[model samples]
Target: MLTEAQAWQALDAVEDPEIPVVSVTELGIVREVVAEGDALRVVVTPTYSGCPATELIAESIVDALKAAGAGAVTVETRLSPAWSTDWIADDARAKLRAYGIVPPQSAAPGGGQVVRFMSRTLPCPRCGSTRTTRLSEFGSTACKALYRCEDCREPFEYFKPI
Candidate 1:
């Protein structure tokens, strides 16, 4: 019988398909791990709906648990309470930055409503400068935005805040 804690620890070895620098748990994708009888169930919430990596992530989880000596591993997808960037672990944020992807920032209190109309300046992941301009609303992935640093003159991807 695999313990919940053991299952989570095993999952630590599973990295996010999109961001290889961080584990799925570090990315806040693994919400819950429970052992039910002989089966281990992993609950996951995707960064966003319609994410192309969802199926791949699920398969990775199942394979990881099985390889860890788990019995009858099951993956459950939960989308009710939409996943938010706020759920991202602080350590994961640092990893993302170190990996050359700007991490998402928490929405300002009472500033969420205005964000829809106003654009926010994103600091460059490489140069650490706020004087970055958006090259496009989309980047290498649908979840990111393309930006170029004014100081470094380098193009980078900003993990869009959700």
Candidate 2:
């Protein structure tokens, strides 16, 4: 009979399948977790709706909860509120940079307090220089955009904040 907090603590230990360096919680993926009757319901916000990672993430969330002794865990994806880069949280952003990916830079709200991930200039992950250019809006993954480091002369991807 684990409490809701206890269940979350367990789920928090589950790391992201793609970014193993950070857990889904740290990544702010788990938006809500609550116990209903004899079942546990978890809400996860997708980084990108079309991104294939959403499927795997949902599976991992369910498996992790069950492994943590959750009697019946129901992982649900909520798109109504949608996911935003702003929800990445400060801790997750740091973990991303340490994981060799250039995290999105926080900027003033573009229009309606919406953190603009793409409008802001992304620095090169290799050289840490702002003098970077976008080679393409699309990257190796649909969630990322291809970029070139002008200073390092290397190509890296910026995890666009969705």
Candidate 3:
């Protein structure tokens, strides 16, 4: 029988499809894990409800647990109390920076507000310069914004706070 600790350890190896540098657990996606009898249930809250990788993430979670000797695995999607960038682990934030993606600067605004327009200056992950310009509201994904660093002349994505 797989214990909750083992399940969590197995899931810690599951990386985010979009951000491969960090595990799903590090991204704060895997909310809870329960082992009951011969079955295991994993609770996940996606970065956003409309995330394109939601289905894939769920599949990965189930596959991981099953591969870890879980007889039956079920993935539950939890949307209420929606996922927030603030839930991101500090180590994950550093990983994002090292991966050249600008992490969210502060806690996401309350009241279910998503920050689409960045009013504050975002430091460049590569050059560590504050002189940066947002190239577009949408980056490689809907959850990020494209930005260019004036100092390094390199373009990068900023994970939007939600």
Best-matching candidate per lDDT: 3
Candidates ranked by TM-score: 3, 1, 2
lDDT of 3 by residue, 7-37 (tens): 9999999999998998999988999999878
lDDT of 2 by residue, 13-71 (tens): 88877778878887777998989977899988887767777888888888877877778
As a whole number from 0 to 100, the lDDT of residue 61 in candidate 2 is 81
On lDDT, the stronger of 1 and 3 is: 3
lDDT of 1: 0.85
Worst 10 residues of 2 by lDDT: 107-116
Supply the global lDDT for candidate 2.
Answer: 0.76
Clashing pairs in 3: none
- Report, for all candidates in order, the number of backbone clashes: 0, 0, 0
List the global CA lDDT of all models. 0.85, 0.76, 0.88
Sequence-dependent TM-score of model 3: 0.93
TM-score of each: 0.90, 0.84, 0.93
By lDDT, rank the candidates, best first: 3, 1, 2
Q: How big is the positional error of residue 146 in model 1, measured in Å on the Cα after superposition?
A: 0.8
